[model samples]
Target: MAVGEEQKRSPREQKMLLADSNGQNMTALFSPRFKSAAAMAGWDEEALLLASLVVEDTPDRDSKHKRRFVLHSKTPPTNSSRKRRSQRTPQPVAILDLDEEETPRKDSGRKKKGKKISEGSKVEEGGNELTEKNPGVSSSSSVLPCIDKLREELSCAICLEICYEPSTTPCGHSFCRKCLRSAADKCGKRCPKCRQLISNGRSCTVNTVLWNTIQLLFPQEIEARKAAGILNGRQQAQNLSPESAFYATLMNRSTPPSGEASGRISRRNVATTTSRTQEDEDAALARRLQREIDEQSPGTTTRSRVHNARMRARGGISTSQHEDAALALRLQREEFMQTYRGSQEHVSSRLPSSTLARANLRSMASRAMNLRISDRRR
Candidate 1:
């Protein structure tokens, strides 16, 4: 095949060829992911297979390309209509442009050539009006109700996500295929979105137009999810119950650790049984006993006694070292106080009272001696 032809081959064709070569039958072609075994109606074999690939694998389509490729039915547009509009400016739709519904002519079991009026009728007419207030019955009521009923039936049970090839469980509830498969995986093939028994084995397919409508309404969301991953619930248990998960993560971030650590996990920790094994307790006991023996062993002992020595050393030297440290600390503090003493304090300690009293006595004695000498000379 030419490179271009090879590149354009649909995934369905590739899968089909692989299955046939491997000696598998038609039933193998259709799976939880692949919706149909038969080719798409109105499309050629190649087109049909391409579409299947698009649906099955490229769950997420390129957004830029979609503006040109996929047209959703929720939006009422046709290619011809778009082309027509493109040729001219688009015009607003007029309500008056709608045609009136035609009234049905009833046969009286015998053919009548002329119009006959009922006894209570106001005017001569071909048929009597069911209600005088209304001129004719309309197609709106019949057409609209069917559309509404379809919408209600197509909604998904889980995440209320739109049902794509929705599968119904024994409980009569429905979910998208990707959604249910995910639920099956996480909750052990049980419905995570709903507590339904998936193993009950009763299942059903989604209505096609309803499936198409979902594709239309949430094309981007579906495609993004498909391209990224199956949006179905393999949803972490936390996501299935968001309120609990959020508070738990928040609490975990804020929580302080126990003797476990300084900053503890506040969030609800979901440690697996295997992650915390029975052997852990035995290992812990072994470690504790080993440590006790090592601590009792002396520094004179070799490295075999290290664990016990280190642990026993915890309080063994703490007290003696602490007392010596405290004494050295007090002596250093007193030396600092003496070395840093200020001039004002030194002067105040040797202040006036005693010196002043002695100076006053010396002056009085000198005055008495001088006075005695002066009296003798006279």
Candidate 2:
């Protein structure tokens, strides 16, 4: 029966049995107990008989057990074999499976067509494809609100607009440079925001980082502001008198003209010309008053005495360094009038108009003298 079973086994099973027997032979040959027994018995007849019986019995039992286990534990068909069999087999055609496979492609095609139509409509209506086509413009549009907030934060407190040529004060407040300068001129050298004293408002340096940021974010606004400022300056220059216009031009000139004197000399010349013009006007007024007084009282000792007193006052006023020359001359005229009033108490009642006229003329003369002395000092 064993022989029949062994013969009935497949060729692959028979090869597996031979490989198992060879492995068992290798393990037993190398085992310590077999080596020790061989050293002591030296291949005895009894040991050879026992080994033969053990080998024969073990193979029969192991072969039966291994064969049963291998047959029972046979692996299921692999994925590749199952897939090949599925492909070869004729499956039933279902309407639902066909529709499901085609649905995604149909939906995707419809979506693409819809997108094209929408884009075409947008282009036709807006006449601008930048928002859709240009990635950079779209990205920038997303942050537009942030940029606007930044612009508000960077705006000048004085002008209530985005700062052009931004300047920071010692108190860390910022404003447009032109606005800051104008504010300082109008309301003293103090920060418009914080009311902190600015030691040198004229010398406040531009905040380079803030300026660059403003330029970067608000280039169009900055250009517009600059153009407006230039236009305003031109309009002011046109409206100004020739002397005032010349002075404005002189002050605005960043560099001196070729072969011209320095700014200090030009400024001194302007001062001298102004003083001379003022002095000429005062002299003309004094002469006109004197002529009026002479016509009113042709040969009055009061007029002569008043004229002498004025001459003496003029000499003293010219020499004195008092800033309030006008007040001093007025005081002197009052003192002289009091003395005249006391001396001419009887004559003043007979010619009250003449006395009043003389007093008025003396007052005018004193004012003229004051003007001349002030101009000379200037």
Candidate 3:
């Protein structure tokens, strides 16, 4: 046979070839026990010989490919009119345009027949109009009630409509994101259905199945809801001053663009985002610790310890002896403070807690104590 030409085998020959290959220990190729044993024993002369034998014993491409190629007999063309006549179910009929093809009948008998045909055409046209107006009336009238029932089950309890941004609770109950968020904010972090405690820090995820179902069933409603939501959000945002809007734009822009880095930043600062009040409490605790250290230790040791703690808290950055590490540390702290201040100023009402109420207390208190001592000396 030519090198490029495919080898063809008869049915009998193909059957025998397949049977011979199947009779061999081809099961070992797929066996987990054999794979594990091979890994433990490692490849050797014996193993290599066995592999070569197995490869040789395996069925060729022609044999495997032959099994997949099915031969189907061609079906004869079907007559549309005959098929339509045979079918018992009624179908929407297309009205024919007869103005172009219609010819005048000169004979009186033929003219009478033409009038009858015209009357029948008028009756069919009326029927087509009725079907067009109430399309799928017979088939879909029964289905609509079931769909409305399903929509009721899927609707948000808070809104009493199809759920927007559907989110399911851990209790298997679902609600719209806005509705759930409103409930969480107004009430506690409790499931609306079961009253089970949900963590305030963790937000609910979108219910994909229910969301898709709602979209498929009530596409127009979903589109209208989305447009309304967009308008409302825009109006709310516009109600904010130019300065607040600009600050928000800047904050959104400052977030890391890379998805991985953004994810890491979000994960690392989750505690910070969860509670501005809690972060304030932690900072207060840190300052108290710093003051106690300052009083107990010498100035050099106290500063060094504080530097080390800050570095650790910030995820320590490495610096060579040539680089001014102190300046870099000061710059990072300043940047962090500025970011905090910007965010706090933008959402002061929402924050409901002072993140920097005691920001410089440690340094200011110590300086005042030193100033009093100097005054006593004077």
Sum up the clashes in candidate 2: 0
lDDT scores in order: 0.41, 0.57, 0.52
- Model 1 regions more than 4 Å off: 1-157, 189-196, 200-210, 216-378
The residue ranges of model 2 lying beyond 4 angstroms of the native Cα positions read 1-143, 240-378
- Residue-level lDDT of model 1, residues 270-316, one tens digit each, is 24243234224323433443343233223424652463345357767
- Answer with 2 or 3, whichever has the higher lDDT: 2
**In model 2, which residue pairs have backbone atoms overlapping below 3 Å?**
none
TM-score for each of the candidates: 0.18, 0.27, 0.30
The residue-level lDDT of candidate 2 at 303 comes to 60
Pick the TM-score winner: 3
lDDT of 2 by residue, 40-104 (tens): 87776456645664665474445545655878846654455324323431212223346778999
Candidate 1 minimal-lDDT segment of 10 residues: 89-98
Q: What CA RMSD would you report for each candidate? A: 34.3, 38.1, 26.6
Ranking by lDDT: 2, 3, 1
